[model samples]
Target: MTTQVVILAAGMGSRLGRSLPKPLTELSDGRTIMQQQFDNIHHAFGKRAKVTVVVGYKLEHIVEAFPDASFVYNEQYDQTNTSKSLLRALQASQPGGVLWMNGDVVFDPRVLDRAAEMIARDQSFVTVNTAKVSDEEVKYTTSAEGYIQKLSKTVKGGLGEAVGINYISAADKAMLVRHLQRVDAQDYFERGIELAIEQNRILVEPVDISDLYAVEVDFAEDLDRANLFV
Candidate 1:
């Protein structure tokens, strides 16, 4: 199946307290966070996957790093959250499924292959990987059947941290985009996804992806923790 990648790269990374864009932040291996994600998808889907990046907070950093990829700048990035940044990419989306993810995460490159394969086989399915985190961290809640119930990253009792990667099918893109529009113009992507579940059209395909932990990079300490995963 042909696939496209949509990476939400507008994060300010208040957690990291860095002046540079979050996408420019490097992991233990010295690859920028966004570069790691972009290359991972490139490896998984090959050239068949054209990537669309939604960027802000040092757009030039990303532009200079990957000159060939499509970039959608969100001028409202500082005011809005991840949801609006995501919707901005819809204008240029191609006809294939999109591998959606946030830019502030670290994961094994193999995770992209697992996510892409799940989407191709499920037919409009949404696959979210289980996160590996400390015991006290808030987890996204889900039903016994694995459908995402609530993504209360701030609250306690989540089943897993969102891996920042999902396979959104073409058939479902419209709904996802519209749902995002209704979100507080300031809401982030996580809120948009939770709203999609409320619409009853969302399904959660959980992968046994404990080897890959997600770091939202909310705090500088989170960066150190992220290094442990990669």
Candidate 2:
């Protein structure tokens, strides 16, 4: 089975207050966040896995950073959100399941290792963390059977917060593409997944990663926190 890894890195890091794209932000280890992500995915999937990066803010810079990666330009990246960028990437992906990761996170390589294991088991799941769920976090509620029942930042007391990493089958990817096309461009990509769950077109399992380090960089403080783990 062919597996594609899609990295969504188009948006400008306005909140981070950095002139560079979040993916290009220099980490404590000197490697950019996207470079770390590429390394981790390569470590888990080897050379066969195709990596497609969606770029918008600084296209030339991102392109130069990953010359080997296939690129999809999100022309309206400033007006849209991750959902639209991901949709563009998914549409350009190969005919198989895809491992999706937001470009702004710095995480333990084990997150990719475990995500691949879940995909190998023929399960589609979103990585979640038992770490403190703040109001700003993208939260989700899972059924007792481990399927995600709901997903939203406003969902108080969720099972865990979404780690912005997930595996989606080709079938589900088709469904998501269609759903996302009909929704608001500002919606997060997970909104489509929530709709799929509601329509019974897919079941998203939540895999816990509380024991591992996964940080979503949204602000200067978050970047500092992520640097601690890096």
Candidate 3:
């Protein structure tokens, strides 16, 4: 099966305070953030990777920037959050597992290489960095069986921080879609994952990539840190 990927870039990214979409922000390497993501995908999966970008805010800019990529528009992007954007992408995807990442993340291409095994097995997973856990970042706790138990920004006793790179197996995608549809409009996509885990027993493993850099550029400092890796 071809490797399917989705990039959630519909938000206005108000925290970054940029006129352009966050994914369009230029990195020190002179590649836009999304361009680097595309490069990483191609490096890992070659021509077999089918990328679908979820666009809304300044959709035209993103569409023009990557003419080859497929796009799904989130008409309610301004009124919703990642949950809705993700739902739109999931609903539009083909019959297969999907690997997705935040549009604003700047990371080592090796991160995707690290996830290759899980992708090949079609296992649902979330990339995590065990080196640091910030209060503002999405954090997670593992179950007794070593799968992800709870995931959210407010998760207490979190074992690590989620790096915003994730996968939903084709087997688990419909359950996640149902939960994503039921989540609040302002809820992050993590909420949907949590619901699926709690109610449906969907197992999502945590893929540790602490040694690799995966920074979501939300502020000026974040951009600075991401530039260091680029």
Expressed as tens digits, the lDDT of each residue in 3-88 for candidate 1 is 77788887676667888888788888888888778778878888657788898888898888988888999998889887898888
Off by over 4 Å in 3: none
* lDDT of candidate 3 at residue 128, scale 0 to 100: 97
Residue 20 shift from truth in candidate 3, angstroms: 0.6
What does candidate 2's lDDT look like per residue over 1-230, in tens digits? 75689999999989998888889998999999999999899889887779999999988999998999999999999999988998999888878788889999899998988888887876778999977788888999877777898887878778779999988876677888887787798999888888888885587889899999999998888889999987
If ranked by lDDT, best first, what sequence of candidates would result? 3, 2, 1
**Local error of candidate 1 at 222, Å?**
2.2
Give the poorly placed runs of model 1, Cα more than 4 Å off.
122-138, 154-156
Ranking by TM-score: 3, 2, 1
**Every model's TM-score:** 0.86, 0.96, 0.99
- What Cα-based lDDT does every candidate model obtain? 0.72, 0.88, 0.95
What is residue 118's positional error in candidate 1, in angstroms?
Answer: 1.0
Error of 3 at 220 (Å): 0.6
lDDT of 3 by residue, 1-230 (tens): 88999999999999989999999999999999999999999999996799999999999999999999999999988999999999999999999899999999998989999888999999999999999989988999999999999999999989999999999999999999999999999999999999999999999999999999989999999999999989
lDDT (Cα) of model 2: 0.88
The segments of candidate 2 whose C-alpha lies over 4 angstroms from its true place after superposition are none
